[model samples]
Target: MRTSHKMDPVSLTGLGLGVISLTFQLFSGCLKAYNLLADARGMPAQFQYLRIRVRTEQHRLGNWALVANLTEQSGSLSTSLQLNEALVQEVLREQETILTSFWKVSHPHTLMIDDPKPGPVSGTEGEADLQERVPQSKSSLEDRALRFVEKMRRYPSRIRWSTFDRERLETSISQLSALNDAMMSLLDSQQQYKFHQAQIRTSMQVLHLNKKVDHLLQLFQANSMQLSMAQFSQNLRLLHSMQLSAYSSEPQEERQTLATLARFKALNVEINLDSDDERSNTSTGIFEQPPLDPRSCTIFSSVPSSYSPEEVRSDGIYENIPVWIEWKYYEPVLHIGHVDPHTQVRISRLSALLSNPQKPTQFHTPSCIGYFNDVSNYRFGLVFRRPIDVSSVGVPSSLFDLIISNEKPSLSMRVHLAHTLATAVQYLHSTDWLHKAFRSQNVVFFTNPGDTDISTPYLCGFGLSRPAQNTEMTEQPDSIPLYNLYRHPLAHSSIAVDGKSGFKKAFDVYSLGIVLLELALWMPLYRVLGVDDRNLQRSLQPGVTKKVRELLLRESRYLEMVKASAGDVFADVIRACVEGFGEEGESLHDKVVVRLETISI
Candidate 1:
């Protein structure tokens, strides 16, 4: 080239084109690599955002449910309160009118008249004085009667009468009657005109009228006092029933509505009460986004790094054999608070037992990896052999949501879930552990990649679990009545009647019965019973145990509905579990597992 050798134009052009093509290839490859790196870096942040969104949606749904319940309570309370107020007003008005009329009729008036001196006087002068006095007295009596009638025409506004005031009014009426009688006697004794007998009779009739008015006034006063007391009592009861404070200008109904709205707003739920269609649409959009991977998310960055060597083993060994790492990052799922030393020991023992592959006990449940203590905050981490989506785990969304959204699960899936739960309970019982907090909400579902056979069911709510003997000795009565819907009626009734905690293996079996019924009917307990959470709460009050027991019995409408929907086999299992067969040496969990195994999908 230095020598300036002459080159072909076509060859020079081919060389330039080839250089350009190579440069373009290098640039494209670099861009793709940069994109891959960026995605990898952003995944944690994206996962964190997804978790936040899922939590926000769950809070929104919870607030919406609360709002629905409050709205119902407001409607019922408003109707009853309004009716009671209207009736009270009507009775008050009628009683006031009666009292006013009686007061007017019994009112006293003053009269003036001239009389002759006590010394004897001439007959003509005495007769003149008497005639003048008679006319003046009659005119005064007529004027007083007119005034009383005019006063009676107006209704009385301030009619508050205490005992003293009532007595004074009665005395005044009696005095007025006595004065009328005296006036009538004076008129009857008048000799000015014997032919005025008709006038005398009219005066006597007026006197009799006074007596009648006095008697009526006394009766009205007594009746009015009784009515006032009755009204006061009724108002007190209404106030109690409304449960509203005197200082609050807002009605209970409005206050509850506002609180519900505020809660919805706090949860980031955009609700428009003006449009039902809009609300429905908004609710449907609540959980539209897919859940994030809890393991890869940075939300658990606050999780402590300190872990036992056994817990930190990266080889992922079960019985010394390698297995898939279901969970990559350890994170706290619940804040259990400062656990008792004994409880901590029990949990540690349980965790070790679960991780020991040498043990014959094996079930489809989450394995407790390890526990951490941060001051008063105690937490534990769990791991599964295969990764799972935590966002779709809770009962409100996984199980209840299916029924709420009108999505029916297949018969086989229900059977499988029921069988898995029974097996898990059986395993726990076999280990002499009691799951004191067993419920549908404690059951979780998982999915394994490339494994489309069946959804994995895990029994995971072991926060309240302990050795059977320990739980029996330290069991506390459940304070939440909503949970009682799943508990055995006898357990609830016995506790209510005797103030004792009736926690036993049979209690768990009864809860299983409720869950099985739920699975069979594809409905939540509240929905099946056609009641709200408030109704369930009210059912826990004193004297309501009997009624609740009757409602939960085998012949109750709830069971009848379940039997109609799920068939005889499922119903029989529920009945047997709920009403234990007093057989000795046979655990309820074992019986339940046996019954579940025999049921065909």
Candidate 2:
């Protein structure tokens, strides 16, 4: 029986085919599972990267929209319109390219290994090939997207538009429209993929991506509106300028010019211009001309009388405005030595808001008095509302000076100062601003005529201030030792995963903590830590909390001074800040305020 059981060729072939089919099915299933796992792992990171990219793009788009609007509004559209429009089209094209690439990398085809031939056996090897290929494809896509984003960041500089070249404009528009179509297609595919994904988390991530895309679309719509407004403003300015020039050239055109001016007035357009004589004069002295009407002024040529030429520090220039300090009327004023075109626009906008009679005063920072420009330099001034002569109060120039003084401030005085400091910070936060350069030197002491319990602390030095929504991160130089001392350790360290150097509220809190520590211990940081300027700089090289703790613990005198002066609650607040508490979210500010309020003194 065994000898007669030799298998026929047909049976053997059929058996072999069945085994191959089974193996093929198993291999196919494994490949599908592998792809799913890979996607599950990779998609979240990709989405996160996409989110950052989108945010950056939104910021760039907003900036461009602002530029376009300002140019149009200022009647300079002819000079910039072509370039700006081309820029917009370029960004849109790049965005579409990124989306297309994202879709391809995120949605690879499912493996199919159903062939019954021996050639199909290579599909098993293909699985390994696919695994290797998918990652390479994803990585290449990411690299391309990143490079595109960087190119977009620098795209503004590359834009060269010639008004005579209608072909270029047409090409740009056509490219943009084609990109729009591609983006829509990619979106549709993403929607399909999202619908098919089984995991809730993955689906949610897809939903997030959809929201981001929708946001981008909304931003594009906003850009269009901004462009329109700019164009309208530009037209108005041009008409007014033309009418004025004609009126000045010919007395007979006076009536027509007046009528045109009246029409502009009816439309609420401002037509104020400097007199010819005023424009012709050239003076760069601190006080070359009388200040503008104080009531309507947003900048002044004044400062505290105590301010000396030596006290004048240059903060470089912003928008071509050379910023410096000067003395006027016994108060320290921020003096803009040159009010460039950009500065004029900002001043005009701010002046409009300040001119509103019903505007709330609580949210306002220091007020400006007036601005003037000689032929050589433009000047504007910001007057400090509260000016303190630290010398009058038996203290030095600033809170920093008081900290280093051998004389210790009373605990009650310390409490009042801390409360005032917290309140000022709370006020700034409420007004949606961050005092990025918050430090003891920035805090000035002012005594109210009748109130004598404690000197009022005013948060001055707004040179580095910015909106909370758009905080800036700056690199600290080795020469700027003050920043090194007051800045959050995380700011200098590489621990932040976000790679952000911008100041945060928590960073403000940390700076406040150091100030409080000085206030509490009644000693400068360098003195309390028993370190020289060199050691102080070195100490900041380590982690903030650990380094601070070591410095506090290493010196018994520091503990004694803090405990003896500020007590436990104040000490705890300082510790919490040093530990990086209250660094995030809206609630942290409230929490800090509550914590400060709870402190008895």
Candidate 3:
């Protein structure tokens, strides 16, 4: 006991406590990090997803960039870099398949892209807690990008909903997984275009110019993943045809395509006119979808005239409503009209001289079969008339895919789109009309090959609409649906375009700002998804919040990241569009935004 008292027990105790404290701290930190990592990896484990699909010509787009990068490294592909390229391509090919299959599955519907909209960031209170950081899990990294397959609860596609097709959803999931695999595997940069070009011009080559599938196979034989330009275009045309058949396959009188729509109308006529008091002055066989011909209706061009039209056609009425035309290439005399609006001047009734198949003497206007190129909104023409294929616009055609992939329009593109929209607004204001619904899909490019890259897109649908400028902004409060997913956010609080309501140029400009971001992003803002006037009336409801506004404000960090990568000039335009509504209004700009001089088409 005497010897122990002499010993330094206090010092020993202090040392022991310090060691325990340090150990506890280390364990606590590790546990916290592990929890965060686990939280981050909340998605399901076995779900392989597709991000997007893009078909390119490999020889036409080979490792030209990699070749350039190789030259930068040492003027040639070092043995190591070549290995890296090979490895990268292997990975890319694997991923690109994911998107390709996604396209195959969703090629029929544009509403949903594969692997889009990752689940919520924060796990709900009911979910389990993880306390240690997980290493970069292979599954997690693979899901870096989103493909946007729809929610499981909803019908996978319109067709699926109509047919109650259980297999469609399963097919969509499988196709999406395959697309995801493709996307992960395909990794060529834009510079790959050079190799592709080089492959296009081999001093001499024996091309087995047979079927399109053979051409693609030959390209594959050349050790290229990119499709030859001709094959690419041809494939697109084939995909377009498939889309058309989908429409035809849908139930008649379903109002999906014009053929069925005509059948719908014929049925309607039969219903209305087949009565005993049938004084059938009009033809009951109007607008019928026949096997011999396919007809469809879509607003080909958006006119600047606002609510009023210069002329009205048999399709609809206007004093001098500019006709909306849909073209069928096979019957160039005008069987089905093109959705492509030529310019300010839309031409319908091209072949008003053909005899109806059944009526030996009746006339019909058949669209001329040919390639029509536009020269800016200034002009356009049907340049070549080889046997052009007639494909009705498909619901989820590759055209939509192309736009989704290539619609990375620049700031200049946004400016042009915004200004053009402004011009439309100015016209609407002048006409005392309101464009109740303005969106990205509603605005598009007119292809004019001669003058510029693409002609100005016109604004079309004013149906189920409102009036702008010096008019009642809305029809009536009661008439307003409580919630419309497509309604503008401001309508949540603001009244109609009544003088005091302030739906003026500035208001339109505000709306245009949202639209500009929409087109620039090629997606709509999802934050303010109101179900009705009542839900919207609540200001901020259960799932509805104005996230886009906060995004424009830079309050959220992750979105800030998305903004940074998208580009500066483009970001500036977005900021400008979202201006004048923040706490300090830091994003607001005072520039007198230009109006489109005029839409020539």
What TM-score do all the candidates reach, one by one? Answer: 0.38, 0.38, 0.27
Write one digit per residue (lDDT tens) for candidate 3, span 186-217.
Answer: 32443333333222222102111111222212
Off-target runs (Cα >4 Å) in candidate 1 are 1-339, 359-362, 374-406, 447-454, 471-475, 489-502, 533-549, 583-591
Residues forming the 10-long window of minimal summed lDDT in candidate 2? 154-163
Candidate 1, residues 44-146, lDDT tens digits: the string is 2212222111222222222222222212111321233334433322322222222233233343421111122243222432121221211122333223323
lDDT tens digits by residue: candidate 2, 1-601: 0010112223324543221121112212222222222222122221222222233222222222332332211233234344443333333434333322222323242222122232211232212122221112222322333343332222111111111222222232233223322222222333322222211112122212221222222222222221234443543453343231111112112212222222222111111112224321222112212334433323323322121232322222223333223221121224743444434433343333232333223323333332333223323443222222332331114577555543665787787777677656654443334566677776654432233334555455554454443312222322344455666655555344124435567777777778888888776676665666555555544444336644554556665667767787677667666555543322333445445656665
True-vs-predicted CA distance for residue 495, candidate 1, Å: 7.9
Candidate 2 TM-score, C-alpha based: 0.38
**Candidate 3 stretches greater than 4 Å from native:** 1-415, 426-433, 445-454, 464-473, 476-488, 493-504, 527-547, 554-566, 581-601
Candidate 1, clashing residue pairs? none
| C-alpha local distance difference test of each model | 0.38, 0.38, 0.29
Task: State which candidate, 2 or 3, has the greater lDDT.
Answer: 2
